[model samples]
Target: MLQMNDKKLYNDWAAKTSDSVMKRRPEINTKWEYEDGVVLQGMELVFNKTGDKKYLEYMMKSMDLFVDENGNIPKYSSNEFNIDHINNGKVLLALYEHTEDERYKKAADLLRSQLTNHPRTSEGAFWHKEIYPYQIWLDGLYMGSVFYARYIKEFGEEAEFEDVMKQFTLSYKHTRDEETGLLHHAWDEKREQPWCDKETGLSKHYWARSIGWYVMAIVDVLDYIPESYEGRDVLLNMLEETVEAMMNYQDKETGVWYQIVNQQERKGNYLESSGSAMMLYAIAKGVRKNYLSQDWFEKAEHIYKGIIDEFILTTKDGLVNVNKICQVAGLGGKDKRDGSFAYYISEPIVTNDHKGVGPFILASAEMEMLYEERK
Candidate 1:
């Protein structure tokens, strides 16, 4: 039986998260290109829960700082055409639908414009980035497909649906391991990157958050993709495969996933917050959507409980802090990330990190909804 303390814990954490965002305007600095998208996702979740006009206003104001009267995003570059950059389009679409803002529409169209010119492999997958040539990270699927689904829904683009299908089909064909039902972190189409596996085009290791992004992408995009489309079944299968593979790696003791998901026996590898939250969101939503059996909901609930108990912290001033979020993981680079167990653990962990926060809010939202429904 749940105690009063458990309820208080949830309420207190939610309130602190809301207060923290409300108290400060997220910085408009140029440190990283995706900062606005991350902040907007957080604000969107907050607004959804609180119905606070200020949260919406905050998101619009920050977006307006970069997007001009003509809808040009100040720091965005079409030449690069990286899929990660497309995430902000979701926020632009939201603002456009809610407010009928022309600037937001224009900004979204600018992102769409990149899709038109971006390079694709022969099988039609968008290369993860121009610099990374022939590589498609599981991370890129979420970054790009969510926006792809949104654009197809908003603009009535039937052709885009085919492209969306192709992206996932190509990704699964290249990255999925038949034996384990798990996806590799990336597939290097060129097979030249040192981390690339010569025969499979897969990277040397799997990273939890990378697959988490892919899982979240499929579930979220499925919401927008037309059910009648033949490709929808392929996506559903892919999502099932992802959940099945992920379930195998869940830590039996903690109900969370390892940073290097399959590396359970590796010394010092620990349960990670962002990936755990992503899996919880995936499983809960998968059950909610009937893509998976209701039994998965039990797994989702168990993991969410574990996350709150294990990763969540209350700061001295009452801020809800999510600890032990691995900073970032990736394949070959000048930095020599070997995609090994040691490399995964070497990444720094931080408190209340946005990577964990957005996913945690998403997981909490789904869990709260499920709990309310069961009650």
Candidate 2:
């Protein structure tokens, strides 16, 4: 249990942890990538909730490193048409809204341009990457769709929003397992990948973080969708359905989800941090937005506590750490990812990966808002 003083500090944990993430990187030395977007997204939430300029400043400084005077990202290449590249557009859009800077606008436009030509499956889901052709990964939903929806809401035609909805609905159609009610990590439409089931084109296991990415994408994208839009309910229904499936697999004793979500009885399976954090974040935001019932929030409260007890760590020097984050996972690359149960567990588990910390902070922000409302 958190100490009494620490309990009071829960309200500020988002900002504090976000700051910790900022201090660790503190520069634009890294490539413009999804990991940075994840952390910046958490910072964006904290800035929204707390009205803190420092948080905003940190965001600006970090982004300014890559987005220059002419709005060029030195390291980015649009020809790649990678869906993960779109993730950073969320921050670019947020930065533009706050500052009304043309550079940010131009940078955002460049990312949006990618979607116009990004390679896709015959059914129109964005391929996870240029290299992984004909593949749609659950991770890509959050990477690409959230930014797509937000971009359309900000600057694109109303009709363009249809493309945003297709990413979710189509991916769900392809990757969803009817028997388990869980989504597989990736779907290869041609079933050409060695990892994919030849007939189904689906990966073998239900990876928790991939589903976490999908769920968080659904809830976050719903923010930009108008209530009058028909697709809004489609997304809401998906959120409810996915959350229900997630809850069924959550370890009753630990209140955290396993890395291979549906395989709790498997010996090597363990509760993972990023996936667990992402799940709690989705549930909290879904409930706060009234897209889900309050009963879900009550259930999420237990899961949130479990996240703290299980993944969050404290140092003697007082820095907070997020442990047990899977360093990286993917399918069908030079690494030859097979996407089996063993492959999922074989990924390195490490501390303070942005994937885990970012969602943990985002989840904290939502929980804090709900707590304040009750008080």
**Best model number under TM-score:** 2
Clashing pairs in 1: none
Local distance difference test scores for all models: 0.79, 0.88
Residue 239, candidate 2: how far off, in angstroms? 0.7
Q: List residue ranges in candidate 2 displaced over 4 A.
A: 1-11
Q: How would you encode candidate 2's per-residue C-alpha lDDT over 80-110 as one tens digit per residue? A: 8888989999999999999999999999999
Task: Estimate the overall C-alpha local distance difference test score of candidate 2.
Answer: 0.88
TM-score, every prediction: 0.93, 0.97
Residue pairs in candidate 2 whose N, alpha carbon or C atoms collide under 3 angstroms: none
Error of 2 at 109 (Å): 0.3
Deviation in Å, model 1, residue 302 alpha carbon: 0.6
